[model samples]
Target chain A: MSAQPAAVPHLEIDGVSKRFGETEVLRDVSITVPRGTFLALLGPSGCGKSTLLKIIAGLETQTGGHVRLDGEALDGMPAYRRDIGVVFQSYALFPHMSVKENVRFGLDMRRLDKAESAARVDEALELVKLGGYGSRMPSELSGGQQQRVAIARSLAIRPRLLLLDEPLSNLDAVLRKSVRVDIRELHDRVGTTTVMVTHDQEEAMSMADQVAVMAEGRVLQMGTPEAIYERPATRFVGGFVGSPPASLMKLSRRFEGGWRFGEIEWQMEPALARRLDAIRRIEVTIGLRPERMRLVEAGTEGALAAELRSSEYLGGERLLHAAVGQERIAALVGGHLSGLPKPGEPVHLLPDADAVMLFDAENGERLDP
Target chain B: MRSSTPLLFLLPAVALSAVVFLAPFAWLIYASFKTQGAGSLLMADGLTVKNYARLVADSYFAAAFVRTIGLSALTTLLTLVVGLPVARLIATGSGRAKGLLLALMLVPLVCGALLPSLGMIHLLGPLGVVNGTLKLLGLTTSSIKFLGTTGGVVLGLVQAFLPLMVLPLVNTLSRLPRDVEHAASSLGASPLRVWRRVILPLAMPGIVAGAVLVFSAAFTAFVTPQVLGQGKIATFGTVAYQQAALVLDWPFASTLAVVVLVAIGLALILSAQFDRLLRRRRLAA
Candidate 1:
């Protein structure tokens, strides 16, 4: 972590943990979001991302630790007193109220003047680009439209911190793509310190300034998208952050200074070579991105012999599913790789040296750089 | 084929309804206009509004009509005052708590009206448990009169009609999304404000349905008032019973019955109208 004199973080989650009876849902999870920064709590289902978000929102209380907003510890404060706005996965719009009334709810609760509330409602509606939708009911709107109304309702309150939990998950694929952009633009315009929870890697990578990848009950990695993607600190993260995840292959130490797997020997980079002494048997898994693996013409140095298992024709790229010893791996080939070897045919697999990531097979931790 | 099969499934219910509901209602409307002895004691004999006219002129019948309406209104209000919170509690409580509370609420529902009245009489009547307790506590010198009073009748009606008011509201409240309350709270609304703006409006259908059901049940309550009133509190049903069974004026009794039926029918119509109006407003909003 760089010491850039962090701006008084708008929100701080310190050692926050939650348990439902005997089930530990969140375990000592902590995150900090500076003002106007978009932080995404990204994780697979049952990973406690939503639980953590709910705790920060005060919808669910943490069993231990604390959450602070704008420097005030949020102990014993109810969700309403916390003044944080939340957009739920179900949108949670008041089905009985009109769009305008729904937008004005928080303002009404605050006892703002009618004229002021109306102005804020209009402004927020326009911010979500649904200005003329005030008179409509949520049931009359499309799913995406309802989601925008929910966003507008929260934004109308002018909350300092906004939380969204899978707000775009209900939309169709095309709408999800477009709504992601809308959400990013909305965050920029509103400038609210925002925290969103999503399972979609693409959505998190594209929209979040800081992506916190969580698994089980803890955050495995938290960094900028590029940092989390290109140099994942953990094997779970390297496998989670990309679409066609990083591949793993088992290797053992050779009698020589290099590593050997099957009948092949490969020299390690200096940094990786030094760590080899600390590693007992050099039994390690090599992580490689599919895009990083190359299908070289036979006789290439530093390439392992393999047999093609199957091939898939993606629009702009062909994916070759091949096997090295009993381990299966995918390699992205050119769109016109019609001459690629058929299943059961011999092939050579080469790992781009710079792209290969090594993890301790026993612990699944990324080898320290 | 699919449509015809469903129609076939519906045919028996439709036939039963025509025989059970429509036929009786048609006969009641015809008998309302008939003369007393000339009418086939079981069926209509003549077409006349004389019985209705006589009912309008009779002061006893008029008072009973007013008392019936007033009792129904009071019972409905009291039931709402008691049932709403209980229903809300049952709706929001945990599964075990809801089941326990529902069972407690249903104790009154399953008890026969006469049985409850019998219980109340033993508890509230002169020299009964309440008077004895009051006397023992130094609150009273002697047993107090409770058997022949309107208060006893109203209390009995409230007990009899309470489940009708609560069940529908509970069903409605259970179906209401808890998200609205969470949304309101997240937006800085107080608990009271959330109930006022979100929960109450969403649960209106259930509330209205419960109120209507309570009012209808209390209006026609027979045994509770008869046993509790002990001949003093005269509601519409008691008046009809007196005229037909005691006074032997079959025509006047039938008139009172017809009037009560009309009033209940009007209430049902109003209930339907209110439900429709609320639905329309919901749609419009």
Candidate 2:
């Protein structure tokens, strides 16, 4: 509805919706990706994140609305003419093709001159650190190597927009990190506009410049990764995009001074108080990130009382578990933090007030300033 | 090195195969080399290659060989042309549609060779479906025919062997990952190109398997062409039946049977070789 901007978005999905028979897969969803930016659609399974990506790629048609590239509506175009690329989760490499052949297929489809196509194929394989893997079949390669081949094949086409569905989900945890870095490096080198869909919050937080959180066929929020984390627009967005994820506490009451969290009536941080426009609202659920809370000795000054439930050693940091009233909270601390607490031991947790988030208990909407 | 116990477990099946398949096949091969005789299934006189030589020299048998091979090949090709799209449709169809399509394809399979032949006669004979429709429309002509011709036999064979082609193709095509096709389309390949490059190459095993099944079934098929051809086309099966029953030249009939079997065997081997060559050229991991 807005007038065409000076610089048209690299890819704009406006009011896109899809329905399979009676079941709505994606509601009216809109997102605009700027050029040379990596965007991620993050959500749990059945969130319609993959469907949204497929719609943009023209792999899946939308029942309503349309997609635009550089301000030009791609309404009637087939996926083959969309000039987008996709890396499916299965890698989906042609088993009957060599890595080089797989990469060359797209270029061949484009009908580039043989020499230029070969050069581009080599360049793409090299870009994915698969320079010598050209003649190798997909089955001959490891899972990570095969994934690299898929990425190489997609990137070789130099698509207008690149869509990757759960790009790193098929890899092991350790390889996921390495491949994640590889993908970031590839994106930096190519500077292509890209969108990836993932269920892993950490993957989204680390890899994407902008993150769109979706749930149940609707996009809940879209912002820079940092903003999406620190200032989530909805309770689902807040709860869906964190390592331990921001915890939502149902049991809270306002005292004469401030709201009570779990067992103790605590004072609110001045910044958080200023952030909440509905400051007078009580019976609200607060989001406390696990890493933001600190553990101290029982009855410590300026800290609420808690009972230690358990503790888990997580390499560099220990994730200590404890219960304050009926709600369970986890606090990340170092080994040097007093030799770690044992289960059933009494303790106190001091949540960093600035890190605490407030939301309406009924609708799960953020009640921010 | 692993276990004789498991080998012991295979005793019944091995004995059954030896008696049921190997014994009859061995007897047939022996009978092919025997001297010509009347009223005997067993080999008589000394084994000789004279009957095979006569079979090769006889232009009648030669024409029959050529006709059978050419017609069977055409039937297999037509089966592929018709069955591939149907298999793909059934593969990508909804649950109920898929079940219905599968059930329909199974009709020919369960109908057996005899029933389809009879049905083809009713459908394509002189006063059958085609001519009857033509007559109703006032388009019937003396020059035109659907049954009692080589083309009719080909049609009948294709119908008979179609399920053999479709079943393996559906099994393979349905197992293909949908993402690969999506990947190809997104990568700027047209739908046709995707079929040619990605879908077809990946479905090679199914194609080869289906072709073999269809080719073998068509080559050995007796009832369809026999019924539909109405004595106008004499395939290897029909001619051998005549030589055995009417002429009672058991040795010559056995010779004809053996030659046709060899031809079918060669066709299968050649098809497999073609598949292996393709795999080597495009793939071979």
In order, what is each prediction's RMSD in angstroms?
A: 3.7, 3.1
Worst 10 residues of 1 chain B by lDDT: B37-46
lDDT by residue (tens digit), candidate 2, A279-308: 567677778888888876665544656778
Tell me model 1's lDDT, rounded to 2 decimals. Answer: 0.85
CA lDDT of every candidate: 0.85, 0.85
Runs in model 2 deviating more than 4 A are A1-7, A254-278, A297-302, B1-16, B37-44, B134-143, B282-285
Steric clashes per prediction = 0, 1
lDDT (Cα, tens digit) per residue for candidate 1, span B1-285 = 877998999999999999999887676666667776742444346678888887778787778889889999999999998888989999889978889999988987787778888998898899789899999999999777878888888888888888898999999999988777888999998888888888888888888889888888888788888999998999987887887788766666766777777787898899889889878887797
Per prediction, the TM-score for chain B is 0.86, 0.90
Residues A128-169, model 1: lDDT tens digits: 889899999889999999999999999988887899999888
Misplaced by over 4 Å in model 1 are: A1-7, A254-282, B1-17, B38-45, B103-111, B122-147, B244-250
| A352 Cα displacement, candidate 2 (Å) | 0.9
**Which pairs of residues clash in candidate 1, taking residues 3 or more apart in a chain or in different chains?**
none
Report the error of model 2 at residue A214, Å. Answer: 0.8
DockQ of each: 0.73, 0.70
